[model samples]
Target: MGGQISVRGVTHVYTNRYTRETVLALEDISFEVEQGEFVCIIGPSGCGKSTLLYLIAGLMRPSMGEILVDGRPVTGPGPDRGMVFQEFAILPWRTVWRNISHGLEIQGVPKEKRDEIVRHYIRLIGLEGFENKYPYELSGGMKQRVALARTLACNPKVVLMDEPFAALDVQTRITLRTELLKISLQLSNTILFVTHSVDEAALLGDRVIVLTRRPGRVKEIVRNPIPRAARDEHTMENPAFIEYRNHLFYSVRSEVQVAEHEALVRG
Candidate 1:
């Protein structure tokens, strides 16, 4: 079964080693993601968007409350969840094929099976001919394709993306987003994506979770009415698309102003 996530009154606190001061990164954040749903999270800078993603990936524990996957509490990292970061995390020295097979290698999968799975994803992500190229030899978009193939090859129940497309150029980003939509539908993948772009969130998410300023709280969860099969580059011109875009833009704008005010006061 694909993963379903539940967050119950979760709060995260961070302490500065030098200052010995505690700051609340997220306060009483709670939400639920149904299995196979594509959920996008957006918030102002430092509103703990990435922190929340990390928390879900089991990279860290919440200071209070709990997170659960498929009714089981999250304790630490496991194969059930895979993470893709804004910075492509592929090994610099490894060729595309080897990088995609790294996770299977760590899990002690036999070389024959690993090769089979890696070859499948290499074709799935459109990196067929570039299998022997190192990270330094590929473009940013190709490197990210390697990162994604590696994650999907592990067969994780949930895919955690931390602004994976933010670093790509506008054209490349759009192309990949469309490709991702197709892949997720084909695989019925469950995903939780963190991004700053309202338009991107509106285009990609089944539901967009808006967050408040620092000490991030769930402000609202906007359900995207656009069907997955219907989304494409031209969908931006559709009235429904424009409405969703406008709504998210306004919702996040208020939080952006609040975050700016807080910055000025701190300064």
Candidate 2:
């Protein structure tokens, strides 16, 4: 397993010069993603969920606190931290194999070694047969597999996902969400996933971290200590699963409702 992630009171503030206003996107946010744990953050849209991902990925600096990986602060993006976004984020011009190994290619990995890693991840993501295809020829899910394989090829300590399946249709999202858990286990890597779906969060998370609306803050963290059996949709129909899902839904549902009302009131 890879190293863990420690976010210590990380605050992100956005400033707009035109209005001379400052927006606190995240305030006093602190959480720990243990090694090999699948933790998901969910909240209303524009609530700084993506902002938090940026902080952990070293894409942006937090205004008030620090984000660290295994006790070391993340000053910049590194191989230890790999990300897969909502968009496919693949190079359309490159072949599937080339896109998967783009990171290694950039890192000066030799063609032989890069090809092997590409093949490994292609198999890992079950895209072995499509190695030579272009992303344009693939479905949304297949494109995402290419993206996931690309990130996995880097062999990061943690995989940070930002609503990676949100763009897909309901069925595809559900399928991928389930597959993601399988992928997480097969890789045994730590993951911090951000999403808007309570069902999705509860379905995949080892721990679900709920955040508040704008100026996002951790509201409640629910531990899904019960592991779900793989490939069994029956778990979702189980009373225990229903209770867990409802509990999470009711927990965050009101906050989301309030945020919506507030938005309409402002408009």
Candidate 3:
């Protein structure tokens, strides 16, 4: 079964306790992610990229409208919708292998079966040698890999990522992006990635969804014409990649300017 997501006229609002004010985070947000499609969301800071992810993940609900996965309303967080955050949420005390097995253990998968599944993903994420290492002993990328492996180990239908690679160095981010692309294709999991980097969005997303500054709303949803099979080093050098990157860059830059202008006006 493929993972398909539908968001209909979603509007989310929050209250500021200190200021005793209401904040409109997302406004009239509407989009649909097809089964097995990879979609990236990018926008200016405070544009509610993460907020949208949270809504879709059912970590919280929109003050209005609804989010559906596989035609069913998303009422709460479930194993079908897994999330990987910027911070490596892996347990520091556990070894990489144990960390990956944590979810399976919770589900009461037998030790032997859980270990088998964990070993496969450890190898899949290139943590074979470091399986015995704890989070502190691993680099940022490796720690993130453990987190990824753990999430994938649960076999989630739709993976929601909130800047999972933002903290990594440039080289590490690039390498992991490639690895993640490969893994996603192999697994055919639907992904909704929230990112600030235009290049990253263009490179990984089948379609890039851009939002306006604050009170985020979909500004544009640009389909990547570049075929996934062609998105290699050669493709990066190709004109199409540069063109798409520039396209998204400009789209986001305009919103960023508007945000800055509003900030200046407030000041």
Candidate 4:
């Protein structure tokens, strides 16, 4: 069976010892991600977008509310949720093959089985002959490909990405973004991507969710028409592209002011 995610009214708050203050990271945030849906989250910096991702992944618990996957409550990190962080979280010491197979190794999959999946995804991510290369040997884009390949190798139910393409140069980021759409669709896994780019959200997400600032709350959920239409290069620069981008732009802009006001009160 495929996977679906449902995040109930979730809120996250942090207590600061030094300041003797309670910081609200996410407040009354609620949204649901259907099976095989590619959803992107965008907002101002420190608006708790990443906090929502961590809560959904069960890396940490929400101060309140519940997160569920396939009708089960998430209490801890599991194979069902795969994460790709921005800093190319791959280990430097391990060779490409070892890093990709790390998750399967943890679950004690047989050598033959693990090797087969690794080999398949190596080619899937276009890392065909770079098996023994170290992370230091790869370029920024290539390293991120390895990160994606490693996450996909585990066969997770959904992938959570936090600005996976944020660090690359202009040309590399664009090329990888185009390729990531292909890789994501071919793998057929549910994805929740977090980013600050309106263009990226419009291009990649079937629906884009915007959040308010710290103590983040869901502001709007917009369905991107292009991905639902004929998928092509020209579709992104189409007339609707500007319209969709503006919808998110204005939505996020309003939230940015809200976030700033909250920040001032807290400070």
The models' CA-based lDDT, in order, is 0.92, 0.86, 0.92, 0.88
Error of 2 at 266 (Å): 5.6
Kindly indicate the candidate among 1 and 4 with the higher lDDT: 1
If both were scored by lDDT, which would come out higher, candidate 2 or candidate 3?
3
Model 1 residue 96 CA deviation (Å) reads: 0.6
* Candidate 1, RMSD to the unseen true structure: 1.4
Q: Between prediction 3 and prediction 4, which has the larger lDDT?
A: 3
| Candidate 2 residue spans exceeding 4 A from truth | 228-232, 263-267
Among the numbered candidates, top lDDT falls to 1
Error of 2 at 120 (Å): 1.7
Best to worst by lDDT, what's the order? 1, 3, 4, 2
User: Which regions in candidate 4 have their CA more than 4 angstroms from the true location?
Assistant: 257-267
Tell me the tens digit of each residue's lDDT in model 4 across 1-267. Answer: 466998888989988889979889998888888988999999988889898999888889999999999999999999899999999989899999999999989989999999999999999889889999999999999999999989999989989999999999989988888788777767668999999988788888999999876768888899987764355456667888878888898888887877678779999
Per residue, candidate 3 scores C-alpha lDDT tens digits across 21-83 of: 999999999999998899999999998999999999998989999999999999999999999
* TM-score, one value per model: 0.96, 0.94, 0.97, 0.93
* 169 Cα displacement, candidate 1 (Å): 1.7
Query: What's every prediction's RMSD, in angstroms?
Result: 1.4, 1.7, 1.2, 2.0
* lDDT score for residue 213 of model 4: 68
Better of 1 and 3 by TM-score: 3
Query: Which runs in model 3 stand beyond 4 Å of their true positions?
Result: 17-19
